[model samples]
Target: MPRSRGTNGTDMNTELGIVVAGVSTIYGRAVVRWAAAEAHARHAELRLVTAQPAAAVPDRYLPNDVATAHRAAAVRLLADLAGEMATGWPGVIVTTDLATGPPAAVLRAAAEEADLLVVGADDASPFTEAISGSVPGDLLTTSPCPLAVVPRREWTASTALPASAPVVVALDESTISHAALAYGYAAAARTGRPLTVVRCVTAGSFDQAAATAQARLLIAFGELYPDVAVSTEVEPGDPRHVLVAASRRAALLVLGSRGRGRLASSLFGSVSRDLIRRSGCPVVIARTQPAPVALCS
Candidate 1:
């Protein structure tokens, strides 16, 4: 077996495994729809993990039976969804699991043996503030594997474009961005779409983005994905704004997070959070874990 270097400069091996977070949320269902297809395409198992809160204790009384009841209901919902997916996509093995704690931590724990973790992201609003809040955002830092966040737009094809739309990715000089670039190439290859490399510069256009070392690194990955049509964009504006505008017509948008922390408090940086909420399509948050080395594969 060929070995590839990791962000920490260690060689590693990878297998096909994916974990998807599912709950009673629109984004959650979207996650299932998108990840199930990806699982089948990669010949991987789709494990759906749902989090249920345990009943609270008053330091003396019986455990809240209400919490236990809610947990059971959540489990039943997940099992039903898993059964439906297994029936719809026989090529993809499907399994359901329940965990305790917040959605972010639960999914992260389940993603330990997974190659990729999938979740749903909603546009942050006061109405959804307490509902979905930052579960998807929190996973950015806690996930041990790459994470894909699907919104309603992409899953429902509300953007009025085919999968042939370009696979857009945010780029920078960081290793995490390179990982995102590598993922962008793989996604483009899988969807047969062109790859657009973008860098949002604070001054004088994105001219410097194409001239950076990371740009060269992207070209290196191009050698492995020879047939992926690739282009570069350097826009002069706030990155949070530029990337969102660009994602409108993109078949899929990919980005890298700068955090390695497992804490929910720091899961999303400004850029990742903005895109996750406002982007026009599905977004994949690529990290340096599970090895981004084969990106130049």
Candidate 2:
């Protein structure tokens, strides 16, 4: 079950909800900064969540005091940074909350009402890699909102594109891919950037049939955003690799979260995960909502 809602309904505001976890790590700090900047721009409130488990407490009470103090120090560090950032971005209100269970599970539950959830890609401890393993994977699979996994070393502080940066959308011959393209086109129009639609066909599969489908998708994309300049490409390689490579040069990688699923409980298909893990640019994972059809008299 999802987390219960708050009575004031402010907790349910999708636009204002963002779950930023793992603030003790460098990657988490990057995510927090980026998310706070975005929240300020969008007039959204930020929620910072940290986790500390009792299992880490030493059996001896004296050592346990030291452990608890360390955890408190880490939390205080994050709170201080968030406070400083909040001062610069007054529109972004930051709240700090602590959870007692697994970090990922706690953060995932909070993501239910969020428009976006941000977390660190790695941490500092030796077991950091192991601890972070399932959190990102599970969140990518089940997060109710879009998830942004910030790499330890980011290219820039802002993921938002420049005024002229092209918006890239990965399109395959699937319903989800088509919806992703539509969302990308709409976003391009909204941001006043040229739209680029990329279709990745396997090297051997790049033939006339694939070309025809690519052309049709391109035409459809153009029709959706007639005012925006649009370009299309049919690359040859693994779709995930091609999309990730292309995303490096593009402003935003717009993609769909739900794809054709052959397995159970697969929130994001294999291709999506690969791109999310490896893409150099910030990715925008659109929810699988049905796009509204154009009405004509």
Candidate 3:
């Protein structure tokens, strides 16, 4: 991952952060639709924000007049998006913010209050090959909340998914990995989708002890999401490749941070970034999960 010019952190905030440029930026609508679906499902607020350098930016890009015009256009774009969501997704409360500064920095500040920060890929093959800076590119490493970058190809309002389109989640030995599983299961349950638990296994990767641990995690999810149809796969191969391919038929892919061994800091790991670029569906990097609440009788 390239170095980010912004602060890095894990755990998506309670709000939804949608990163938008003045124009559609190509895949912006896909992100908004996805975020709207998420907000509706989680019963959370949607925060649509457009971060810009400045209307009076000191040369290099657009002139002051042109830049100011661009900012105004972007603000209008947010209003249009908010209006569409308000009508299209009734239960999801939508709001907009237009801030002046570095887009990435504004994104980080916005992420601070977002449970999931959604962005669209400027370059379609960004993950497979290499490309320039993207809204979620450098920022991926330090996103305070889980980040979802819908691919240009997958950015659409089509809810037409086959029943087989499951919510596939990658599992690891990390304690935080369970958070990814829980998130995946909940997403599946909410949307009445199936859930698939996958762990990439090498030849001798699953020793008896490891197998038992994996079963434990699967069983835990089953207990929680008893009504959701579930399947398990100990696929043989690289985890990133396996998940990326599987995502072609998936509705979403959820993953956990590859923790800094013992250092106790979180950064978006290699697998998460690779999949975000390559996955056919939306990819979510599970930063942190909110604590379970008890029902008051």
Candidate 3 local lDDT, 1-297, one digit each (tens): 111111112233433333322224455676787777777777766777766565464645756777667777888888788888777878556767777667666666777756777776554322212122443344565667666766766454327788778998876433336567767888899888899887766554455664565577667667778999998886787776788888888888887653222111122254555566678988776665443442100
Report the lDDT of model 1 for residue 76: 75
lDDT of 1 by residue, 1-297 (tens): 122332223224445455555555345556686777777766777777776544466323655675556667877778677777777777566667776666566667777777778766662322123224634345666667787767755484323567558999876432336567767888788767899988666643333443555756776787889999889886767777888898887978888754466311121254676677788887887765344454433
lDDT of 2 at 11: 50
- The candidate with the higher TM-score, 1 or 2, is 1
Mark the regions of model 3 whose C-alpha exceeds 4 Å error after superposition.
Answer: 1-24, 54-64, 123-138, 173-176, 203-211, 258-268, 289-297
Locate the minimum summed-lDDT window of 10 residues in model 1: 1-10
**Candidate 2 vs. true structure, TM-score:** 0.73
Can you rank all candidates by lDDT, best first? Answer: 1, 3, 2
Q: What TM-score fits each model?
A: 0.77, 0.73, 0.76
Predicted structure 2: lDDT: 0.60
As a TM-score, model 1 comes out at 0.77
State in Å the error of residue 54, model 2: 4.9
Candidate 1: pairs in clash: 206-234
The lDDT, on a scale of 0 to 1, for candidate 3 is: 0.63
- Encode model 2's per-residue lDDT on 1-297: one tens digit a residue: 233332223454354445454455455666677677656655666777666644654546557777678678768876776776677667566766666666666676767767666665445632133234543455655666666655555545444556566778776543335446665777577657788888666534445654565466557667767898987787766776788788777766776656222211132355655565676766666556554443110
In order, candidate lDDTs are 0.65, 0.60, 0.63
